[model samples]
Target: MGDLANAKNGLNIFLNPLYYGKINDNLKKQIVKVETTKDSAYFERIENEITDELNKRLSGVLEDYAEIKGHVSSFQSLHGTISLNKASSLDMVHGKWATHDDYIADWLSGLKDSIESGRPSMMQKIFKIQRIREYVLLFLERDFYRHYKVRTKDKPQENLWSIWFGSETLFWGLLISPRLIEDNWENKPGRIRKVEFGYWTIGHVLKTGLVDPENNTIYKFRDLNDFLIFYESILKRVSNSIYEKQIFAFYVDYIRKSQNPLLEPLLIPEFRYEGIKQKHKYRLDFTILNCHTGERIGFELSPQSTHMAISGIKSKTQTELNKDLALKWGREMQKRNEYFQQYGITIMTFTDDNLIDMKNCFKAMEYYLSKRKADRQSVDELIQDIISIK
Candidate 1:
């Protein structure tokens, strides 16, 4: 494996059998060889199967998972894979192997429950296992042939101890049968948090990657330090008002305190609007992407000095200045509404009054920082309001 470190914890995905549809012929030949030889040697089997030819085949199939280091975890080591294999294979003899149909039926039940619970991530996990079920059946079939005893004229009951292929199948089954994926999602650094497109507007905006407004180029940051370096560069070189800079200093402190491997608030400076480009289309001063929940919040630093300033006022009449002021105010409100409607961003403004107590202003936004939901009005309150009006 080239750049084996890049594959890292993602070797599980590379080893996923379903993704290698074209390798079915090669896999069938390996199964046949194992069956004829009746060899249960784990490491020997893997080393033999993972030949230069097989690796070439795997390269074509596993490019996506192998090359993408961000998709992998540092937690899963070679030792971990072997440990999982030993544990699962030892237990395989104690339980009856499920028929292919039964296995699929169980997966469908889990899929239904996941969907009803609104867990698309869990559904995806189930689907991955469900797709590779045929490979499991192939392994079972191979075992039946390999363990066949001439004296008994029957398949001898045996535990599967093959590390590479057996472990990968067991891993997929464990992921679906137990709540391993969900457990990792909540408590461990595993899958990169991916937002589905329909879930929120911010999903569509940052779907590709973060856009650097300074250069209008894509910037990929893997860690807090990467983001901080990019942010510091913008502050030193880009033109921002003193108030905005002060607010950003506070934001940096907040990000530092809240930063974690799983959940980090990305404060993108001057996040460009996804709406139609126009003179009125103002980039958000700061857009905080809550990676944990896929929620976006916009911080607008609207100090009266800059927001309400009328340029070339001395060159215009009183009526012209008033008209310009009205237009400017109109555009500001329109931009706020547009952001909310188009990007699902809760735009919070900090005027001079709000900036006077800037710490408290930022504090007020704590509620909208997570998964946002509309508070439902109670029937009792509705009835009371109706009676009071009469």
Candidate 2:
């Protein structure tokens, strides 16, 4: 984690995407395009200046979170990995006569054998477990396995958490899940979940935020900060219950606020953005027009993107529900039609279904809208006749 501090700014992306929607490629390009206008010298100077300041800020924040001073970080990529020490003998389980290492490897192998046997009974048991979390090769003794954990910078909690052995690992350009995200924050929740394309075993640490001065050398998924990093692709224990609920709540709030005509036409989203604040006057990833108030506000489309602003993660950063947000701006209203295409926005997300895009939403409440329009039309006609007489 070269810049674990780079995380402090956007670590909650797995939680709230409004935070990450800005730093995306499209937005970065837009920011570069907007700021670089005819002044390469000024732009480069600013970049250098920002980089210097960022180093300071990131270092400070990461330290505050739990990173020990003078500890060298082995995790480098944006999907940062912290290489830690692994000792087999010390990981013994009392009475069980099994070391943590042995137990883990055994578990992995048993799981593999179970899957490989093609037994229906095992599959049924696995179906239940799969619902809970994806099987990322249970380690039976020493045989190590690998998985691709996708997420922004905060935490590679979970997105496309799968083991890659063959050709899939070759191209490894961060394969985004070919699924509707955003309104679904199952794996990608709260930032800093690393996507490991290796035989990486995550270190489990206490949440007391205290770092062991002696074990500072272990850095791959190491626990320096109170923020826990897991190399396992899926966040099995807590994802469905906590992550999904929290992000979905945020999306629900967004929809609720959008529905309130206090603004005008609802600001429909074209895409999501991560870190737009640093670049624009208003940082937004989604665009929506309010039909009544006629205020087309820029929305930051995040299933639950929060406010850290760093960028550069391979897998976790690929399946952008926000599309970098640069694509949503400046389009004409007619574009909203896009072939009637059930025009709507995802107001909510979860582990399974993307809930309540505007199109479906409007259909559900169609009667109310129709009646409101009718009432307005009658009033307009009455006024027009009165004016005509005058």
Candidate 3:
């Protein structure tokens, strides 16, 4: 009976569009040997691990979510779902998080209080932990339903991305932390938090929640939307961005001209069109404000914070030039940022007016400012600095 079942399953796997021509026969032969040894020992190893992870993470019971890994022989998607595990078994249903409304309500209250009080207690950390864990578990279950397999009640299609996936799960959760600080009732604090501002596609982990002192915060396992926003911020131009690379290039020239005319500026005009890395020539449309670097200072620009972008038009008549320039400046910042990273600085985005606004952009600038001051680094160091403000 087991042999017959394997024969039938193997036949279907070979015929499946996702696996058929995409993978060669050699890999397929190896996969069969591994997932279906006569003793089934190899297969059980992954199954037990995945099941245990699901059991530990999931709050409620559902076979669909519980036994997802066992049901699928293997999965794959190239719709550009880049992950460390993409080339292997394509089980990504373990991503995303779920949330409950009442929990969120309490979380919001606590989070607001913590922010205002200027102290994040253990209780607050727990709130951050619970909310973040719950949200991640929920997202994984939701993905199981949407992409993995149909519910027993079986609708032909999914209803709403928001229905299954809470759009404001973390957005509001960050609003409601365990802290008792007072803050504005209406703001979505997720956007202002430190991790949300990263320019790299470190992955979905950073995308889901406000990382606190508890449960580690990094993009390696962040949600899709969070990754998207970070990616969008880095790659896409918000407004008034122009040859962001060239602008930065010219800025460097301007600095040299004023301070060290003997020190010639970097002449990477090829990057203005060819891209800084030369592979993905995606341009940004923003201004790259070289963090008022002084030659005496070793690393002046906190490439993370000092980089500014003009999102809204300066005068906003909705003219082409205004929109185009907004985009152009965004590019300059991203491009110059390539050069800036070598010095261990990050690029922060600010609109032209906001850069001058002093009130709004001051703190954003200080994130990298402090990083430049510290001996330790990486995006993690800037997290608290950026989160403490908004």
TM-score of each: 0.38, 0.15, 0.16
* Candidate closest to the true structure, highest TM-score: 1
Please list the C-alpha lDDT of all candidates, in the order they appear: 0.42, 0.26, 0.29
Q: What is the lDDT, from 0 to 100, of the residue 54 in candidate 1?
A: 40
lDDT of 3: 0.29
Which regions of candidate 2 are displaced past 4 Å?
Answer: 1-248, 253-283, 291-294, 300-390
Task: Write candidate 3's Cα lDDT for 1-390 as tens digits.
Answer: 332233234321112222311234654454356434423453354334434554554343222222322442222221112122122222122211111222222233334445567763322222122222233323332233232222111111111001110111121112111222253222233322222121111211233333221232312324443433432353333223343332433333343344322222111111122211224443223222121121111111223233433445455566765667667667766655653543332334444555344434434433322231122222222223222333
**Per-residue lDDT for 52 in model 2?**
44
Q: Candidate 1 at 314: error in angstroms?
A: 6.9
Kindly list the per-residue Cα lDDT of model 2 for residues 160-232, writing each as its tens digit.
Answer: 1211111111111111121224432122333233321111111121111111122322123223222222211
Stretches of candidate 3 above 4 Å error? 1-47, 52-364, 367-390
TM-score of 1: 0.38
User: What is the lDDT, from 0 to 100, of the residue 377 in candidate 1?
Assistant: 38
User: Against the true structure, candidate 1 has what lDDT?
Assistant: 0.42
Best by lDDT: 1
